[model samples]
Target: MHEQDFEVDYLIMGAGACGMAFADSLVTNSKSTLAIVDRQHRPGGHWNSAYPFVRLHQPSAFYGVNSRALGSTLATRQG
Candidate 1:
């Protein structure tokens, strides 16, 4: 089989953040068909195995995609 064999608007290689976001945008803006495939069992890419110290280095509000807000919240230090 070749590229022409399968019919799809977008062939997403990985179901990572970028791929997922692209698919989401396509779904909301156009009627394109997407084929998302990932080596991992689920999405989130490296995040699935990210280091324990890895997190929103800044704030949650600035960590999410533009399409969806992370829900801005007032950060409070816990003793």
Candidate 2:
């Protein structure tokens, strides 16, 4: 196998909601480089494997990274 090297200030183990959120916060608050690693083909952790019909148990606003909203504000407002 070919050898590779990476240099980063932070190495996150997962690319799930929490991990992504943490990365977002770190990026917004600091100038550190980050490397996010995940086993799945995409991010979102378990959500990626969940059924398409599955829904969030709480408001969408409460489910994603701090810098962005998950869904329409009207949906959260109605709940």
Candidate 3:
């Protein structure tokens, strides 16, 4: 891999749901700069592979970072 110097207060890998949320909290709560790198063409991890109208098996509040709310627009997994 090529070597490069990254200057930032925080460096996060993977723009997966958790990573994105953590980065958001850091940026929102502090004056620090951040850099995010992900191999996926898009963010959201496996959610990208899932169809819409799908809700998390568990409560949305239980999924994301504690610093933020994932919203209460909960969906049922049962048909």
Candidate of highest TM-score: 2
Report how far residue 25 has shifted in candidate 3, in Å.
0.8
RMSD of each: 6.8, 5.0, 6.4
Q: Distance (Å) between predicted and true CA of 78, model 2?
A: 22
Q: Per-candidate TM vs. native?
A: 0.63, 0.70, 0.58
lDDT of 2 by residue, 1-79 (tens): 9989989999999998889999999998899999999999887778878844664667676775655567675344332
**Model 3 spans with C-alpha error above 4 angstroms:** 1-6, 50-79
**lDDT by candidate, in order shown:** 0.73, 0.80, 0.74
Q: In model 3, which residue pairs have backbone atoms overlapping below 3 Å?
A: none
Residue 26 CA displacement from its true place in model 3, Å: 0.3
By TM-score, rank the candidates, best first.
2, 1, 3
Clash count, one per candidate: 0, 0, 0
Worst 10 residues of 3 by lDDT: 70-79
Which regions of candidate 2 fall more than 4 Å away from where they truly are? 1-3, 54-57, 69-79
Winner by TM-score between candidate 2 and candidate 1: 2
Candidate 1 per-residue lDDT, tens place, 1-79, comes to 5565577988999987788888888887888998999998987777777843564466666645645656456443432
